[model samples]
Target: MQRANAELVRSLGAVRVIDYTKEDFSASGHTYDVIVDTVGTAPFKRSRGSLGRGGRLLLVLATLWQMLLAPWESAVSGKKVVAGPASERVEDLRFLAKLAQEGSLKPVIDRRYTLEQIAEAHRYVETGRKRGSVVVMVSHG
Candidate 1:
């Protein structure tokens, strides 16, 4: 992760933020019960050694092959690979909204652009250096 983003997550109570550019967290001799790979950079093979027994690897952006191999991997290793779309139930969304409204949930927004600048926004995001959510403003209000 970028340095600024690392600090942002730290401020949000992240126990530790591994800057992959400088460190290889998996080789650090630490084990975790759950590792969430939001960007799909950490694949099952690369992360298997870092997981404790019965640990879960949640792949938010899994490839088709990874999804297909998840069950077999889990069966053999006792570590689970969960790869799929996220649940977007209304109640869950409402709960998140409530948390945000109550100031209990803080979202990191790295940048905002007007609707007209959407193409530029996409270009920037494609660079893969963005630290947090990039908002596209549809209206002034």
Candidate 2:
């Protein structure tokens, strides 16, 4: 996590936000029961030490090799690694939508682009500088 987005992340219910640029959370000697990595910056090998006994690491995005090695690693070690594509259930989507509607959840939109500017939007996203979700508007007109 970047220092700039730390506050925003904390406001979103994160108990603690570690700026990877300043410190390495894995080397801090602290352990967690569950660690969800949306990006592949923290892999199983590097994160194993940070996990407590029977801790679970959820990898939202992982390589094929990592996915294949997950089960073996979990079996060998007491910690578990879960790597796979997320399952989108309609009920879950509806629940999230309800939360957003009730102001219980707030989404951060970093940028918005019209359908015609989609190419430019892709370029910006590829740069990996966007802090939040990029919206592409489809105009019928």
Give all candidates' CA lDDT scores. Answer: 0.90, 0.90
Give the CA lDDT, 0 to 100, for residue 91 in model 1. Answer: 98
Cα lDDT tens digits, model 1, 1-141, are: 666677887998878678878888799998888888988889999999999989999998999999899999999999999997766899999999999999999888989999999999999999988878899999856
Candidate 2 per-residue C-alpha lDDT over 1-141 given as tens digits, one digit per residue, 9 for 90 to 100: 655688888888888788787899899999998888877889999899999999999998889998999999999998999998768999999999999999998889999999999999999999978888999999787
Instruction: Show the lowest summed lDDT stretch of 10 residues, model 2.
Output: 1-10
Pairs of residues at least 3 apart in sequence or in different chains that clash in candidate 1:
none
Each candidate structure's TM-score, on Cα atoms with residue i matched to residue i, is 0.86, 0.86
What's the TM for model 1? 0.86
Cα RMSDs, all models: 2.1, 2.0
Give the C-alpha miss distance for residue 106 in model 1, angstroms.
0.7
